[model samples]
Target: MTVMMMKVFHVLLLLNSVWTLTGGERGVSCHFGKICVFPCKFSPGDNILIHWHLTPGNVQVHSFYDNQDQLGQQDQQFKGRTSLFLDQISEGNASLKLTGVKVQDKGTYQCYTSTMEQEAKTSNINVNVKAPVQKINMRQTENLIICSSDGIYPEPHLSWSTSPPSNRTFQNQTTVQKTEELLYNINSSLTLSDREDELEYNCTINTLSDQRRASWRRRPSVEIISGEATISCSSPDTPLSGFSLVWRFNQRQMIVTKNEDDEQRVSEEWKQHVKEVSESGRLTLQHLSADHEGTYTCEVSKDGDSSITQVSLRSDPGKGNSHVVIGIVITLVVIAAVIGLVVWRRRRGSKCTKSQKVKKRENNKLEKSEDNQDEEEETKMNSS
Candidate 1:
């Protein structure tokens, strides 16, 4: 009986050792580009050694011995990125903190602890790193609107919404592509309606039961070059909502109009210059001269609701104004030169006239002296 009891005690010790070696079964979830901690604890003592290793790769992530961290053989991948709770080391806490955790960190980690009095003990933890999904793009291409998102994990769900509320669901097609890194790239497309007014389209991507979601809204915008500017009007979304859009020049006369009934009308004079009027209510003029430069009004009306936007096209007048300034400067320069010449000539003429008068007076004085001398000579001759 004593021998049998001893054998049973040995069997229990073996089972306990096996259980310790196996470590824990539950895993931890972490996000990429975040911090992860592998928890460990022991009784306070000296001559302690705690080492952490990444399994499968057998990489030594971190180690501590003689009351100090020893990284002479640390893994190159985890260099300068792993640390321990140094303050709590004396209290037997050997938790490992990893900074800037990456997708490669998704694996099993082993924390082995040894002391002078106790044998080595090992604990295991599994980490699952999740890559976040951001950067959703919405673009309009011709008659189709496409929405896409890339680099997402654990799959993502997509949904769409429109403003001004409509019961009709857009016929959308979604495609998901998986990358080599186990991430997903998703795209959704929908055909637009030939509508005049703008409609707001919203695309949303939801992850893991809506715990996280990202949405993007499409806003209509118009951009035209400076010279021969094209006055094209657009709503938030088209080929989805049919409404009437009208183009008015200087807010006075209607230059063009695209009705919801697929009818487009252009003014008689505008026909000569209208280059292309699209079904989407975009009016492009061939040559945008000064007559076309003014406040252009885009009026949209649908179901008793109307929106008007005025776009002022002011001619640059940059080169033209520069030329005018040069002409004015030249005229002023000529006028100044003419006035200076006239003043200089008048001053010269006055000085010449004054000098001539003085010369005439001197000549008259000489003639009087000659006549007086002749009379004196005659009197002397008479005396002789």
Candidate 2:
């Protein structure tokens, strides 16, 4: 009897080793701060038991017994964040649902379950948590181009590349900061070459789960000489089959919008300025004056990804020259008026001097005549 009992014990040990080595292993992924469900199953029976533990430390994540949750020894880190499907437990579903998942929650989990008349079963689940990279913003100020993104996890990476690839190495700076929520924010800037030739810049943010890219090409301000201009949404060679395009002026006013159906809508306020939209999404603007001198942004969106191109507009140099010419003409008119007033004053003064001299001469002649008359009267009186 002792020999038989030892043989049965050895058989049980071998069976246990096999189960430990070949337990169901799978991977599950969930986003950070979201719910994650760890799949598990067992045979249906009376008085079911389920327990979930973190591997390596065997930390208790959740437990179920007596047809209810038994969390007396649950880990503090997982308290109030772990749950089981109570309604689905009797059907042999031993899945554990975790809420508000954190970065530290990424690990291997062990789900153990048992029943009154069935052997205990174990499953290993590898959990992966991710915070995907979102909207990347790219802008340029003179020769400096900046790109940034916020609220990403797993420490995103930033890289810069240029189109029409240049041989000259670019100088760039990058920084990463942690937010209060423990997510990452990345920023990078690139100093472009002094050459004014057209070049396209691309900024990319990469993570284990997702990647986002933004492309921009700085264009010199357009000087409209003919009171009209045509601004292309993208390169003439780019395909616009499944894309939607939007044209905005100064970032607020919507100038025109085109959808995938090839329908174009122009804002009422921009009707006079927007002349036509071509099949390739080129915008022809008419009657462009000083009021139209600002930034015009073209956004192309397809499948949730967007590419933006910006063009700055300015009134014709001749328009500005007209202002300068008007100022010069006004100054010349003022100077001419001043010189004409001085000449008229000098002529009037000379005329007044000549008139005074003529009056003096006439007075001298009258005085001489009066004196001769007085002498004649005296002589006549003496003769009488």
Candidate 3:
């Protein structure tokens, strides 16, 4: 019934008397290899207590000595892996060090402390044991291949597979430190085979989160022409579970699938017109004619974001026959005229030099003569 008890009881009553603040709080968080401090500052005689516990209703991970020995059952997953920086506790350091972290270590952790007057206040700590983002750096180590994934936590697994999903040889070494937390360093390697599909090697790092699996992909690549004719193909960096290739000829459409209905009638349009280099995404047409011109698009996709390329094929390189030829010739002539004007301007003016003036006058006369000749030719052609 004292002032403090009245206020404490009132606060606890309002807090549902759980003596704990459950939701809506800036909880505890730490990177795998870094030191994370869980604040647990309580007045010496506040009748409040603090400790750490796990779910499935377990005992404490560790707690500061009220003045003597530490108490509470440390989590098994966290056993021999965590240590309360006991030195800082007296000065208010509730930080814990988690060592040799694994991918399974990421989760929501709690920091609970009770106040006899009020209620138990709990803070949440989110520990993220991130797997290294597989970095694909291709290297030829004297016929032995070298690919690495740095800048990651909890050393990751590196793998190489063919598109048809065949296992290959690889070796990896992981180094870790408690002082550095779970800041894991891994050097994985395997004697890569010298295959014709060398560039088709894919490296992936696997990790799990919330019962979901995830990965990154680096697809094999090739550059192809847009039109006339080109091959839309890739060897692939990783093995594919399934495979399909299609060529589309809508001129505007970029994907065209092969006809698969009848077992015998398999030859499509592009196949008849274009020949591809075996086992590669390279194509060659027997002859590139004007009519064979249209946008030839290549579609390549695996997992997500299939790529479609627009290859512009030309029905006619510029325009068509005689009229177009004449028009082009006229255009070229106009462009030359403009270029001559610019050159003359830069030369300080055609009028400034006597020789230039003479050349200009001669050119004007020549132009007049050329116009007359052109008119005569046009009249003759029209008559013919």
Candidate 4:
């Protein structure tokens, strides 16, 4: 009898080990404030029961039995945020759906299932919650450009790169701070190279769930010589897939917009000025006058992140001609002043020459009169 009991105990331990090996822990990643699914399954059977609990403390997260959810004992923190796949429970799907996930929900959870025909079984899942990096704010101050984003989870990394590739290394300073809600915020600054001209700067933020990038290029003011002009919305190297482009005039008036599908929409007020929009989001304006001279901004948006480019327009058909005309008038004035100076100097020289000739004639007359007087005195003395 003792040998038979030992054999039965060994069989039981072997079965338990097999169960533990098959129902090991798995991982499920979820974005913060988004829906998360914990996948589990078992052999389909009648009288199914499912219960999900937070491990280490056995806090009830969700429960189901008798073909309906039983949440009376559910933790208050998971109230209204947890649900089970009721329709698929009969098929052995015991997955739990969690909505509005928070940092507090990140931990190990146990899914307990049982049926009248089969013994109870448990599966463990580790939930990892993260907040994706989104909406990178970028700005330039002098030679320094700053890139920043907030409300991220699990921390984030920031990097800087230049277009047209530079061999010189740039100075970068980055900081990550944890918020009171256990989320993270990242800020990075890059020192721009003074020797680089028209070099595009790109900033990228990376997280476990998502990565976002933004690019900035300083453009010189556009000069429109004729009555028409074309303003490019994006750089040639910029990617346009899955992006929405919008063009605004002076930051107030919406001129045109194009979606990812290439559908274009033009504003009613700007229909007269908007000639056409190219496939690459270049805006063509016709009948452009001085009124059209202002800042034209192009905004490219995807998901929740955006990049912006601005073009300043100056329209004046006669501007170049006016400059030329002013130059010509200045040249003519200088020429006229030079001619007047030359004529004045010549007239003064002629006057001085005439005065010298008149003085010479007066000296000749005085000499002739003195000679005649001396001859008359010599003749009188000889006669006496």
TM agreement with the true structure for every prediction: 0.46, 0.68, 0.32, 0.68
lDDT of 2 at 92: 84
Cα displacement (Å) at residue 103, model 3:
3.4
Q: What C-alpha lDDT values do all the predictions have?
A: 0.70, 0.82, 0.48, 0.81
Candidate 3 regions with alpha-carbon error over 4 angstroms: 1-24, 27-35, 39-48, 56-59, 85-93, 116-118, 131-137, 141-146, 150-384
Tens digits of lDDT, candidate 4, 278-319: 766788888777788888878788887677676789955466
Candidate 3 or 2, higher TM-score? 2
Clashes in each model (backbone N, CA, C under 3 Å)? 7, 0, 23, 0
Error of 3 at 68 (Å): 3.2
Off by over 4 Å in 1: 1-19, 22-27, 56-59, 70-76, 117-119, 161-183, 195-199, 209-384
Candidate 1 vs 3: which has more TM-score: 1
**lDDT sort, best first:** 2, 4, 1, 3
Better of 2 and 3 by lDDT: 2
Q: Give the TM-score of candidate 4.
A: 0.68
lDDT per residue for candidate 1 within 1-384, as digits (tens), equals 354553354345433544457444447787767898888877666566777888776688998875789999998889989999999988889889999877778888887775555556677888788765555555555577677888777688888776666577698999999887667889999777555135556667767733233222233333333445565455432441488877787667888887888677889978877777665556676655556666676766665344455455655565424556688899999999999999999999999999999999999999999999999999999999
Q: What is the lDDT of candidate 1?
A: 0.70
Model 2 lDDT tens row, 92-119:
8899999999988989888877665666
- Candidate 2 local accuracy as lDDT? 0.82
Report the C-alpha displacement of residue 346, candidate 4, in angstroms. 36
Off by over 4 Å in 2: 1-22, 71-76, 223-229, 237-239, 244-279, 284-289, 303-305, 317-384
Ten contiguous residues minimizing lDDT sum, candidate 3: 209-218
Cα shift from native, residue 314, model 1 (Å): 12
Candidates arranged by TM-score, highest first: 2, 4, 1, 3
